[model samples]
Target: MQHEAKAARTVKEDRTDYLTEERYGHTAAHATMALTGTEWGVTTWNTRPRSVGRVTVCASNGPFAFQESISPVEARLIAQALLMAADDAEKAIDAAYVQDEVTA
Candidate 1:
């Protein structure tokens, strides 16, 4: 029983480390991408010690910011929504390019 408890603690610590590293990488990527004016950045950080996490979405150029404390389920939903929006944007841009090609 003692060994099991120790193993569980190790697992939790590893998970926490992974989450921290992931957040750091994301922040760095956002900083780089923001230079190109092509990406808005979302950053996640713990809001209440180890208990709660908040995700902040902000424009790369402007002062607009949106933040929310989200559960795992909500995070997944937001991820899906962002993916769909990106796909739509890509399609619109491709269509515009084709139209310009035909006009020229």
Candidate 2:
């Protein structure tokens, strides 16, 4: 099946068209450890339509030529999972340090 291409719309346009309340957004970039000269951007926007608040996450990797848009719920779930993973990573690091101290 051939997919129809829709006209690209900016975040501002999306907010203006769909959102009808307060807006909040944030963007950040991170360097990829797996590839040199690769950067990934994460942008989150708060959108509310008639009191139902939603979030949109846009991710892009220039070097990899990839982009994605994530819905509000999916973004929240992913964020929670990431936070848990980070906690686990920190615990592992602390354990390693404790082991080194015991050995030394």
Top-lDDT structure, candidate number: 2
| Candidate 1 per-residue lDDT over residues 27-49, each given as its tens digit | 22232232454334444444446
TM-score of each: 0.47, 0.50
lDDT of 2: 0.48
Candidates in order have lDDT scores of 0.47, 0.48
**Candidate 2 C-alpha lDDT tens digits along 1-104:** 12121223335533522212111332223323234434434444445443234444333355346655666687689889999999999999999999999999
Candidate 2 clashing pairs? Answer: none
Off by over 4 Å in 2: 1-37, 44-62
Residue 27 CA error for candidate 2 (Å)? 10
Instruction: Give lDDT: candidate 1, residue 83.
Output: 95
Candidate 1 collision pairs: none
Question: Which residue runs of candidate 1 sit more than 4 Å off their true CA positions?
Answer: 1-66
Error of 2 at 99 (Å): 0.5
